[model samples]
Target: MKKKYVLLFLIVFMLQHGFSQQMVLKKGTILDALPVQDSIPDTFSLYLPTDFTTEKKWPLLLIFDLEGKEKQALSMFVQAAEDEGYVLAAPRVLDSISLSNSIVKAGKVLSKVVGMLPIHRERIYTAGASSGARFANLVPVFIKDVKGVVSIGSSIANTELLNVKRPFHFIGITNKNDFNFTEILAAKKVLDRFRFPNQVLLHEEQTEWPNIGYLKKSLQLFTLAAMAKGFAVRDSSYIEKALREDIIKVNRLKNAQKLLLAERYLGEMMSIYGAHKNLDSLRQIQKNIRKDQRYRTMRRAENAALFKESLLKEDYQYYIEEDVITHNFNNLGWWNYQKSEIDKFISGNNIYEKEMGNRLLGYINALTEDNIDIVKSEALIDEDALALLYMLKTILEPQNFDFYLETISLSSKNEDFGTALFYLEEALKNGFKDSDKLYGLEGTALLRITPKFNALVEKYLKDARYEIIEE
Candidate 1:
């Protein structure tokens, strides 16, 4: 009987070993993407570290792109993940997929990756950008064992859905120009109310992706959170190193006279490390800093600015819906006036108004982008509504000549000559200098021959009133 039991134990061990061998992947390369499941078009990409082997389990980050740019998103984190020793996976969840379906696909990815790679189930995380970022941050609500998320260029999708029972660390990345900038602050407040572990990295809002340094910062946040919460065994050396670097950063910002930035970073460190490490020294620094008159004024002003942002967001949203539904093209002038007012506030000396103005601009543009998306893909198609939105969009984003041309095309096609003529004048008044393009607009057969159209030609192009530019 003893001999038989020994043989059975040996057989079981071999079987388990065989399974693990099959799961091992080539190190230091992004493996070809695989389907998440049988029928779903959902697929995922992966990158394993050069030293990664089935011998040891690694922490995992399941990243995603809402538009199915999975490999690109995965690549973005490759350097940071490699440096921090994380196994990264990213799902190519298409934008066309419903959010619930995307969530289901993500679950499949987690299950498959956990099985194939020796992933530490307890250390699983998620990440993405924009709408994908919102979805990544939203996943912990449905799934379990998501320890953290790196959400870039977005805020929490819906605060009502947050669960305090299963708290996850959230790291938000955005720039001042990102439409989600103010929304992130608002979302941070909600996270604070629930006492969730969170940090935000605000970068320069520019045309390019944030520098690799930002990704490294995110990795540090993840590492610190994991250690602080005891999800991973504590690494005192790493913690000490991070704290020291952060201190240097705080002092650097203060010396640069970026007082608000310095104060914000100090607050983040206190929130993250207050209980985990000795913070008396940090507290003293913070207390002395808070007593400064400029710091207090800036903090108070920011709160007032946030309140103003919320109120203006309400106004922009109400007008967007009302104007779209009512086809109130007349309100374009009012919208233009609002934009000019925001501009004045932006260029003004008062810090509070300037901040509010910048935030409001981002907020309105985000709303306009959403409205444009709905008009393109929603169940109900409304051309008139789209045209009215274009008219308002031209005013809200006057620098965009696309809205002007779209407005003109839509109005002329719908036989609304009066509205078409009014916007033509408005576009010129707004300093649209492209006179050649103005006379060359296509698809205006019925209305382009009118005197108002000819007037535009004569006033701007220096062309004869009777002469029409043909496409």
Candidate 2:
């Protein structure tokens, strides 16, 4: 029989230690050097379990690491493979090709080697850290049947490379004091934005011999790998319940932690949504208000009172309202502040603002800080004051609203319909759509009230020419 079809029901092997232990690795070319070209040979490796020789071909786990020789990461894979019942492979990408070319060439070779062994070609999996993680992410797209990927200390920027949506679990492990913290954080943000179901594992917090983090990392890899291969380490509901409990335990704040937590949470909300007047859902309103010290101590009895006040109040003056929305020189100041903040938090730039104006500008621009200057400047309404005046006039006279409507309509037409609709709605609601000369403006205003009006009339002059002329 060919090696793959050979039904060896029971197989065993001896290790260098010479003990005839209960075998998991089948005697195969698990570790071997392969000749890629005539002269250049590349070393590849794998671990096939003894149980793999049973009735069915077993699945395989692929590990890509720096030179694929990191013993700790490899050991974790070994234990996990045996525990979960699968073959494990770790390929030395650097030994074969450069970092950039290693992805395709190494993946093809790995798939070829796995094919010769008694492995379920359909259940191949991959995991890696840093450059290794990058390769694992690339393989599933090119390597035919890679079912899942575990990305550690790396991020997927070009998401098109990820062909299989089976299951991707990203675990970020970075030393808190590592100089690469910013780069790692940027990678984490990219992963988050991609909506990958992931967990940001901070390794610095786990301080023990060999570190508690290694255990956490290994478990994450194992759980996700098992999930991809259609196996259950524990009951699904039990796993979810455990994860939820852990979130609660970790996220709960202690004494004096509430203030910082509130600041961070509100700041985040403001950053995301900006100065939107209508915040969605009661849950969001409550979440925002609960961050404040005043509302933090609120009881069930005070719910109604707190709820009403919080929704109407703009007491939050931190990073959200000030920095993102009310800055002067949204002209230049806002852009500069955003760049600086991004440089500070995301890029690790540590420049101190030497000029007081710039520092004051940052504060006034901050959603968390006082924005009195921005408020004052907005009140002044300097040069473009005529537009506001005309807008007010249009509001008072619905009939004569033609001029304002025409301007906004033209502006919207140049852009997209959404922008046009926004301006149109704002003009109407804020009384800027009225025309004193046109008595039927009120009736016309009522006709265009719904959002459906924008879609219906975006190409109105062309398609609905008769309708416009009739109006």
Return the top candidate by TM-score: 1
Each model's TM-score, in the order given?
0.83, 0.40
- Where does the lowest 10-residue lDDT sum fall in candidate 1? 4-13
In angstroms, the error of model 2 at 295 is: 15
Per-residue lDDT of model 2, residues 1-471, tens digit only = 335322343333323233342332334325344333323455556566534655566766777776646344555566446545666677667634555577665665565455455666655667776557667767766655675565554555356554334435444444333323334456556656765544444443312112433434444444544554455333556445534443343345323343333333343333222322233542364465566565455333233433432332233223333333433223334344444543343233321112212222222223221232243357563322222323323332334545356435443434434534554555555444233322233334433443345334433322221233233
RMSD per prediction, one decimal? Answer: 7.7, 23.1
- Candidate 1: global Cα-lDDT? 0.78
**How much is the lDDT of residue 233 in candidate 2?**
35
What are the per-residue Cα lDDT tens digits for candidate 1 across 1-471?
A: 222112111011112323422332555667667655444566688887766667787899988787768898888888888778898898777878788987888888888788656788778889888777888987888898788888898889898988898888888888765557777888999998898889988675453357777887788888777776676778888888888988998999788866777877888888777657988888888888888897888888877877777788789889888988787868878888899999998899986688678778877877887888888787877988888777767767777888888888777878888877877877777777775576577767766677778777578656633665565
Residue 277 local lDDT, model 1: 91
Deviation from native of the Cα of residue 29 in model 1, angstroms:
3.9
